[model samples]
Target: MDPFVVVVLSLSFLLLLSLWRQSSGRRNLPPGPTPLPIIGNFHLIDMKNTRQSFSNFSKTYGPVYTLYFGSQPTVVLYGYEALKEALIDHGEEFSGRGSFPMLEKVFKGKGIAFSNGNVWKAKRLFTVNTLRNLGMGRRTIEEKVQEEAQWLVKELKKTNGSPYDPHFIMGCAPCNVICSIIFQNRFDYEDKDFLSLIGKVNECSKILTTPECQENGNQQTIYSLDHLASLVTGLFFAGTESTGTTMRCALLLLLKHPHITAKVQEEIDHVIGRHRRPSMQDRIHMPYTNAMVHEVQRYADIAPNSMVHEMTCDTKFRNYFLPKGTTVIASLTSVLQDSKEFPNPEMFDPAHFLDGNGNFKKSDYFMPFSTGKRVCVGQSLASMELFLFLTTILQNFKLKPLVDPKDIDITPIGSIFSTIPPTFQMCFIPI
Candidate 1:
């Protein structure tokens, strides 16, 4: 045989073996787009907007499908039914944390946000107990958030209707709240140390560490000082970024649609009035404002992919098998943006949460904070922060967009993991 033919045969044999192995591994998995030897379905994915790519896959492959991330086969649970089935119905078996190499490098799987199995359970319990002890949905943390809202309003008053980017100001409120939870104190807006602290949080943040939590921790295995540090950092990053970005997106949407902002303000006036601080008590009476807040989260669609999950065992789900250790991604974008649940989901309408009689209507499709066993730990706290902070801002002043409402763009800056509002300036015209 010719030398070229021999070399070509060797390469062909290797390629065939690689493809055969990939196929054998994916045998019992849900059907999906076919994979090439190494790259797999990566070419089908849009690096900038992976959620849409995965969603697109569901068109042919149905609600559940598999995609290859390099040589690794990962399952994607898209749409409401599939997500509910996996994250809610089969919650435990699907609740194990999945891998993300870059984030893993930073988090090291020691904290609650990244850890799995016994470590996850232990840390999750400790964090939950601490929050409950600190009064998460009750008056304690609420008072701290309300106090911070007043401070946030004070800073806006300083702006005095001048056009400015709200990026940092929007961030400070949530950052301080999480800080108060962790450190038992809040910082002045312009404090030099505060700025430095926020810069670090911007780099990476989360944790509500107390002496009690520290002393209570085992400090022998998963409860080491390192685990505590990662938890704090995870809290700072997770708590601050998601809540702050959502608030900022709320403001942007208000600027883009003044009518919605007006309706929210009108509700604020009717329920809480200008003289009093907005409370969780107001959320019940202020249906429109509450709906608007839910709409903001749904429309903003922040945290698109959510934290990935790894299967705890070889699980049978909806006629398909997810082998033990298989990685799964429940596409949050699909759930939040489902047209069947929210008519014209692409439209930014608070009416999605409103009944025909005008009462606030709740839908099961609202999973902005995600669902099931691994639901965001700060869901209640974050909800309180968003509602209080938003209502307070609208109550104190009106959003004055620098441009015409029609011209103001409300589109989010899309990422593989999150949907963030673009940077823009607006005025906080005192009402």
Candidate 2:
């Protein structure tokens, strides 16, 4: 009878007891695949195709269900109805941002994208107000976008219709736009300092698994330098990568469907004309073009899993109990790809967002930037940038794929956090 054997038996007994309690506790919670003791349902999910995995889980568990990420219970809301219920209808109850281990190290919970409670409320209000003051929805922002689009077009023209990789060029444009908005000035694409900053932003974006937390700063009312850095980093990272990736995906899809690309160019030409740059005002007049943009956001479905949210308190939702601190996800991919809303959701059809009269159509299910109280703060700005940049490029040049349109692969390279488009070079033939 060794002491080590006695201790081992005690530990084993406690582990079994904990597992029993965990199983019994979930009786009133949303049904999900039975999770093991330590790993939980982590094995149930395909790390690569997490979005598709969640979608598959929904087929068995219904729209609202539970899954364990490690030992934490995470409730996932799939499709438009469940998303609307939790995110919009019960917005306040579900407004808490979920914790992330990696982001906590970086953000320390100071940024608007990840902070919750009073910190989130104050920062979000300040950010929204600051952005509005800086002309987010105004002409100043439009001009900045136009200027960047001009820069992008010039760089693209340098390729001279020869094969040139566009990943960096595409990234630079949107990243500079965020720079201009946050710093009140844009940086040269090749400037060493600016390039370094862009590198940091890229790093933050790639660490998608990171969660965030907050602590008190020097001045109670003002954000400390660390907090400010985290805040700006989050903004620049989100503002640049998501929008840039979407634009890249849009171009890739357009190259694949030349007819659709032609239609977009035609609409841009007709509504804004070549003499004048495409403006937000022109968006209302160009239904086909507008629909194309919406379709691109929907089809690309960049941020498949929306930012994680945590419950502030134990909450009863749709007859299921979600405990306090449980992480929650409203799958944008599920909503975007809902076949019930978008017929043949797999196909990249702008007609999904167009009526028979060729007018732009809208759907409650289009939640690419997500919906509800915590929808992306830069949503409007991102929309403007995407529209302006995409149209301006189309207005100036016709994009030609290096390979045959049919041979072009539109599949995203990375699928876990973001739907990163494959590295590609396109011929930006001048019009």
Candidate 3:
């Protein structure tokens, strides 16, 4: 029981532990900041600004590096080169969704967004085919979007040039669109059940919004109550929340840059004419408006890091060995904001998606929805809704910020889960 003996034994044990970790870390895993015993490199993270902190780490450790959250080692993919390589080129090995405690608590890992293995494959195929059958790319879906856009414009007009926050007003249209697809019918915005469902989208818990399902065939038999609940909630969160937030960002950005807004309205008017609502076909002819929507998505850079991807098996990527079940984050923010791909990447410029000839330009790095085999299932539907909703609003209203355009802060508020637009009021005047 000698104190000196105890101290010497403790010191020796610590030395051995450090050596073991060093040997393991250097064997094949990507290099990163040395982690502490339990906390790992969590102390190195700037919780308030996660993307910037990750970018700073990339500067020190190159594009691919490891950061430990507690005992779990998470490999982060930075910039377009690294992101594209892992998510697209080597997709199969990196397609599995990692364990997310909060999402697991809600989804129970049953739906397409968070599920892996056979469950995910079955649900994804069913959902995609169902959406296609429901006319996702056809005029049937476009007509629904146009109808919601009309309702949105009607609601916005009620403000009568008053400065008001458009968050709920913006959200209702997208929420109903997803509702129609999932429940086979849309609810009135004023309906209590509809409002209650919208409020549950952000909660890290199960929602009680049930869809009316009819016994059809093998697919219906496979889809249990849990399956349907998870699917509906997953689609609601993905379909409603992200799309609504992006539209809010688009409007705020337009208000911040009135000249840009003017140009978009002009393009909409010239291409589609004021007498009718915009359509998917019109997206081709209205390059400038299309570019503006692209720019909004790029600038918002929502979902900076993708939902974690687990390595299906041990894989070698970019000359680094990633072990089986290793957690990976494809940083969408890094790709969208890469200066090489986008000149003045921080600036809100539609020219990023426009060619010198004024045509809508597509970039391999425009990955707001993430990419690869696991790209968002609602991609086509969300795109149609964003285009129609935004153009319709612009066609009918002039969004004037209460303050000077330069004074408006377009910097997003939330940093961890999403890069949300700051709260501000704008006067939606009828044109």
Candidate 4:
């Protein structure tokens, strides 16, 4: 062969080899919606309503679909089976919570919610045990809730059955409960620092739900005001807004379904009586109320998307490979709205948790708190707060709509990190 011909053939072979390597590198990634260069799929995300948009995307791309937002690759797990498999069945493989550069900057590894590995393990365990020791799931906690509820009732009564916004007042009540558990004290409604903290938290929540922040450019440092702002906002939004919104949803639902409300009141009145306050011990006996609370959680479906979980090490789910550092998000909304599991998922029916004989029935699919190791650290405390605040409020007063029920919009406002909760005026008519 000619020397020139041999050299030309070798150069062509090397060029083809380089192209093959590039194509193979792309193939190694999980399939996802086509992402734009640099931006990825950040443009496609509905930062305002992430759960709804992601749910719609999951329908098109199957349960385990990949999405790129900014430089991060996110694996979304839709529906009960997928979420359960990721968070429970193959939990260890998907246990690590995804760490964003901004989040690291804010948290600086202080709390249970964001920390990972042994640090997360120790913090979460300590937090949970501390809450329990503080009587979070017991009668002592109930007394605190009852005290707050009485104060709220007095405030509502002062409204003289006039229409009023309950969002701010209602929100502060539950945040105070968590504050008592964490800080060993509750905040008065007028306290300056307490109110300032709540304001900061609310602002942070708004920033989180907004799409504007995503355009702020990639941050490298682990701590910055932007990150801290987002972190505080996320904590307040998650800690207060979620539990509060669920209670609001429950109140609205009870008002619309008077018969159910009546039943709950009767049950509460029967077990605890009008003279005394309802206790946590009464939860088992007041099955209807327990079932109703569970239904509220299911229907409200707050935190539709569980916190994104990251793979600390290369892991495999069934045969699907999840590479190290891949972000996994469990869609709680899909699971709660599963038609197969809930029959009529859209309807707000308390019967979903009730048996033929009217006894409370626990369903395996009711996972509002999620599951596995990284499951909500506040689950036990949130449950106690929800049940106590809700039942106590209902026992003392009836939530009467100020206008036609149809005019009272339950549709959420604000961005998607947490439900903004609807704005409506109601008269808390004393029973």
Q: What tens-digit string does per-residue lDDT give for candidate 4 at 159-201?
A: 8878887877778887777676656788788799888877866
> What would the per-residue lDDT of candidate 1 be over residues 208-239, giving only the tens digit for each residue?
11101021335487667888899888887777
Each model's C-alpha lDDT? 0.85, 0.84, 0.83, 0.74
Better TM-score candidate (1, 3): 1
Answer with 2 or 4, whichever has the higher lDDT.
2
Best by lDDT: 1
Candidate 4 local distance difference test against the native: 0.74
Candidate 2's displacement at residue 74, Å, is 0.8
Q: Output the worst ten-in-a-row residue range by lDDT, candidate 1.
A: 206-215
Clashing residue pairs found in predicted model 2 = 100-211, 103-210, 103-211, 104-211, 108-213, 109-213
Candidate 4: lDDT of 150?
A: 75
Give the per-residue lDDT of model 3 (tens digit) for 148-260.
88888888888989989998878889999987776678888899999898888745312211100011224553488888778878888889888988999999989888899
lDDT of 2 by residue, 1-431 (tens): 89999999999998899789879878988999998888888888877778779889999999998897767788889888898999999898898999777667777778887787777887888789988998888899999999999988888888888877777777899999988888889888889998897787677666763221142433464466766777788888888888888888998999999999999988887788887877889999999988999999999988887778888788899998888888898788988998888999999999999989999988888888888889999999889988999999999998888889999998775544566777788888999
Candidate with more favorable, higher TM-score: 1 or 4: 1
Can you list the residue pairs that collide in candidate 4?
105-222, 105-223
Candidate 4 — worst ten consecutive residues by lDDT sum? 214-223
